[model samples]
Target: MGCILGRHDSFVYPTWHSDPLSWSSPLDSRRGPLPLSPSPQRGEGERHTRRRAPSPEGRGGQGVRTTRARRDGFTRKVLAWYARAGRDLPWRRTRDPYRVLVSEFMLQQTQVSRVQEYYPRFLARFPDLDALASARPRAVREAWDGLGYYARASNLHALARVVSRDSDGTLPAEPEELIKLPGIGPYTAGAVASFAYEKPVPAVDTNVARVLRRVFFGKRETRNGKREVWQLAAVLVPRNGKRAWKFNQAIMELGALICVARKPKCPGCPVRPVCRTGQSPVS
Candidate 1:
């Protein structure tokens, strides 16, 4: 065990022949030392990373392509993809605020498949804000029993009361105004406005964030950069009447179906032409 080595001032010494005073090994023995490689410095191989592209947060919510032309081009391709390949979920078939609100809450933590099981019955029971606001808390909870996250139902009930009593029994058309309702966060408010009222605003959740990162930032970031993702989504949303709503929905749908967290389907991706990691996965 005498072949141990020592490091000092970036220099290495083998205890076998090195001066005992110059270097000492905790397990110094007469067996002789072997050569070793230096450890990698912090971010030493970062240059070899496939995609070191700058995020929108780094460039004031514009990412690499700041021009309106590139942004619009990306938006158009995504919308086209959605038009041809988007899923035909029940939620997409309506513009009713009440129905959209019910769908959004049902979808918050539950999957689309499971939400389908109860959405129809729930909506049938509480057809409007007046109906929901007037219903008992126990009834609402019962409708949401198998759905889990009972708080979403509770909040929805509370929101119904607020809208019915304070705001004419109607959901607000503005995203900001919608946010004041119970259980209506940024995502829900934006979703309600865009999907129901057709407002041109960004409504990002985890899935939307993944698509934005893969398309613009060339990576994935759910936390720590979520606000940045939302800002970027808003910037990228098209202003062509219904185009913004479609664009926001398109990006989220793309993330869920194609640009998934693992094994993204680059071949069928309409925006893959401009994707960094898609172009050079091992760059």
Candidate 2:
């Protein structure tokens, strides 16, 4: 139950599994879809078998890989869970960068229900980046009236104009390029890149960050702990772009629906077995 810190002071917890694929669950796809609600906790007598996992570098030291042991199993479990439980939202159905961009902009500092109400309506008014760029600022603001973050509206408009003019109405596919656009930050940029372009990058929004902290770090982090979470996220993402897209969305969805900000349903979480916090006595 000891802990170690990397050179950057990011916490890495040891896991017991020797083979990432060795772990199996009754929730396997062959059996059936997972129930919507979490199952009850196990009896006190039941516990997982333990075996020391090898470090990424094959030797332990200050620079040991944080995600080496957990990455494959963690990604597999989350992706499998998502295949069964993920919501079929409108934005999730498309790879259109403009549509994804709009969703990201509306989703910032706003609730998903409200965004659902306004998303189709706004998209109906301005169908693409060109349409948004061509519309007057007043019209754009009017479209964004209920979303509340008026500045996001302004920034979205600015971004549309910039991208429309410069990129020939196509949004950038890299986080680095996307971040340069208006209203888009690291999270939004990564979202756009992965969701739209299937880029294998990390997007550490509030929900994703919480899941990463509790599951990987095994404790609550300070408000400024986002950088460490982002690092962990980057390391954990699958190298394959398609799998990475699913991984990114799966983690975010897990955070929003199961591993919520308060009263996280750890008992039902797909990643619970490998999760530091979920496996801890306190959870």
Candidate 3:
């Protein structure tokens, strides 16, 4: 387990914890801290066998030059960059599930600056799930006025109602369960789970997808490439939840600020040494 260090004016780093009670944010007593999927248990006395390592093609979803050392280096470089340049945003400060949900909903297809303007205002009006659930539909829509994609607001409202009524106002801490909520797709679910609950999961948005493809696959976007990108994302996520949170945020930040869709700023990229696109002579 890991704990978030003090809110630094510059960089924020995740520190490992021997005791979970020392965590920066209080954990849900019921669900506890969710972990990555468990490995299959092996029976005692089973004969050990050595098998040939899989070829690059056989190791699907991993990076182009995937290896323990390579992966660890990649993680280190990204975190170091984040330490130097990660943005201090409103959503990154809290572990409250309700606030995370609202932020994720508001951030969909919206710029960070715009979300920054609207997030606090929306939370001031409807502070929690119960408040959002009890609000009138028109009011919710009105709060989301300038933030295009009105359907997201409606879905978030519906999700709040369902959670309040059926789940006793407790938002689920797991991505699998979070996905069941209205308006929350895979990416949003992962975002809320990892960001709010510190679950070790990948949150792949357009920026994340772009970074993963260029760094790992070294190719332009394709309809068939999404599955591989997600696989690489999942494989690359840190096992520690708090570290994973920083990793996900760092990668997304890298994509947004450096790996722009048009003419990426590769000269300043931190992970350019290991990135396929960055290393390419043509790129």
Candidate 4:
């Protein structure tokens, strides 16, 4: 398994160890690190496999272009961009499961800046599952003031109580298990699994969805194309849970900062050549 080199910033997520054999080696040494086995060589056919479905005129017996190479190129660009430009957030500072869980819950339908203010305070008040589970719902709600999304606060309280009682005061590390908790959906589950437990599940948020769609599918209209994007995301995550964490974060950061919804800074984008949407101005 190949290693993933994280960004230099102190707040960036920590470097993930994919395999014991490669653990001691430098992260930049890995070449063509595929989330799946036997990383594929860079080529045209492989690069175009991820492009959009053929148009009606190009359908029938006509050959359809694959975007596999473009996907690989885009992935590399995004990863490189991520290594240099990923954000520094409080939750990313630690690999603690509780912190990741809290961050994920608070982040739903909320901005990172807003969540930042509430995160430390909430953690300070609850500290751990035991504290949260033992605290009154009203107290939890009080701590969640200004965060809005009252449902998140309520569900978090319910989740804490359940986790404390059922899991012996421990949060499950697996995505499947985490999904069983209140307020945890597929995205949150994948996030906690990858960010907290280093699982290889893909977490597709709005940013990731837009970036993947534009870079791989070349389709600006993703309103009805999320499923395909998610499938592609699943295929892109390395089987190694640790590397998956880096891959997931890198992609999300790319979407948030570079492959933005409007006037994407594609010129400076690492995956510019592979992107079918044309070159970015920043490049």
lDDT of each: 0.65, 0.67, 0.68, 0.62
lDDT string for model 2 (91-198, tens) is 999999999989887777667777888999999999988999899989998999977758778778888888778789888775555655666555776788899999
**In candidate 3, which residue pairs clash?**
none
**Cα lDDT for residue 167, candidate 1:** 72
User: Residue pairs in steric clash, candidate 1?
Assistant: 1-29, 2-28, 2-29, 2-30, 3-32, 3-33
Between candidates 3 and 4, name the one with more favorable lDDT. 3
Leading candidate by lDDT? 3
Q: By the TM-score metric, which is better: model 1 or model 4?
A: 1
Show where candidate 1 strays beyond 4 Å: 1-65, 220-224
The residue-by-residue lDDT of candidate 1 on 3-107, one tens digit each, is: 111101111111112221232212111122211211122232333211111224445433334455666778888988999987787888999999989988888
Clash totals, every prediction: 6, 0, 0, 19
What RMSD does each model have against the real structure? 21.0, 15.8, 11.7, 13.7
Report how far residue 261 has shifted in candidate 4, in Å: 2.0
Q: Candidate 3's residue-wise lDDT over 1-283, tens digit each?
A: 0111111111110111112112111111112212222212223245433222222242333424456666678789999999899989898899999998898877766677888889999999999999999999999999989987687787788888888987899998866566555665557767888999998877777778777778767765444465555556666788798999999899888877887677788888898998878886434
Q: Candidates' TM-scores?
A: 0.74, 0.75, 0.77, 0.73
**Maximum-TM-score candidate:** 3
Q: Between candidates 2 and 4, which one is better according to lDDT?
A: 2
lDDT of 4 at 78: 70
